[model samples]
Target chain A: DQQVKQNSPSLSVQEGRISILNCDYTNSMFDYFLWYKKYPAEGPTFLISISSIKDKNEDGRFTVFLNKSAKHLSLHIVPSQPGDSAVYFCAADDTANTGNQFYFGTGTSLTVIP
Target chain B: DVKVTQSSRYLVKRTGEKVFLECVQDMDHENMFWYRQDPGLGLRLIYFSYDVKMKEKGDIPEGYSVSREKKERFSLILESASTNQTSMYLCASRRGGSTYGYTFGSGTRLTVV
Candidate 1:
């Protein structure tokens, strides 16, 4: 069973526009959520993270919003740049169940067209 | 900076051969993981070790095994390589806590012919 799921397989956005990538999880025990970006032939790098205690977290042009009630989270990149084009993965972890073991989504390929 | 180094960037092995993928982390992290990424499959954990000599099986560990002899190294072994096992393998390490994210090494692309 896939605990974490990224419904959109890919997304294309114009440069300088807002790009939203969404994720959903079935496990209610998950308290920590994170987003990672991966370029071709490279490892996925951590972009942002949000804890269940907070509804939203932001860093520079990236923001992550978590909705516990809906079991959904979204990563938004403001003024998306061509450099942001890569595969985005959303991950969830239930610390109480399995510490530091995260469930990853299939990932969404984001393209920032310049 | 934390550094996780994978021994090989790419490897080609014949089917039915034993294959070993090695990972070393310089941060002395207690937790290390082996994951294989396939198209539309995301990252599937094959094995993980939270402490030296302690191993845990992940969601997909059917044909994979792991070893953690030292605190800085984790090795993933395929008893017998299969064509279906060809994928990009990623190694990651993190401290034993939920607050920190994982640091991944540049993945190794393994091909079994």
Candidate 2:
């Protein structure tokens, strides 16, 4: 079973516009959510994260909003740039496990037209 | 910068051949992991080690084994490689406990013919 899902495989946005990527989870035990950005031929880099206690977390141009009631989270990039184009993955931490195993979604590929 | 290094970027092996994928971390992390990334399946953990000489199986550990002889190094072994095993292998390291995220290697693409 897929605990986390990113239904949209790809998304495109115009430069200077907003780019939003959505993710949903079925497991309620997950308390921490993270977004990772991956470039071609490189490993994923951490972008932003939010705890279950917070509804939103922002870092410069990147912001992540979490809704526990919906079991959903989104990553928003304002004034999106060409450099922001890459595969974005949503991951959740399973706190109930001793290893703190992280479950990752299928990932959403984003392309920003500059 | 903290880094996880996988030994090779690409490899080609014949079926039934033994394969070894090596990973090392420079951050002195206490936790290390091995994962396989497929086109549509996302990243699935193969195994992980929280300390030297200790290991645990992840979601898909079949046909795979791991060794962690040193604190900074972890190795994934494929005793008999198969075509279905061809995929991108990633190694990651993180600090022990529940507070940190993982730092990953560039990944090694292995193809079993």
Highest lDDT scorer: 1
Over B1-113, each residue of candidate 1 has an lDDT whose tens digit, in order, gives 77999999999999999999999999978899999999999999999999999999999999999999999999999999999999999999988865788999999999999
Least accurate 10 contiguous residues by lDDT in model 1 chain A: A93-102
**What is the DockQ of the complex in model 2?**
0.69
lDDT digits (tens) for residues B7-60 of candidate 2: 999999999999999999999999899999887788899999999999999999
**TM-score of the A chain in candidate 2?**
0.98
After the best TM-score superposition of candidate 1, give how far the Cα of residue A101 lies from its true spot, in angstroms: 0.4
Please, what are the lDDT tens digits per residue for candidate 1 over residues A1-114? 999999999999999999999999999999999999999889999999999999999999999999999999999999899999999999998887654788999999999999
TM-score of chain A of 1: 0.98
lDDT of each: 0.94, 0.92
Q: What is the lDDT of residue A17 in candidate 1?
A: 99
Among the numbered candidates, top TM-score falls to: 1
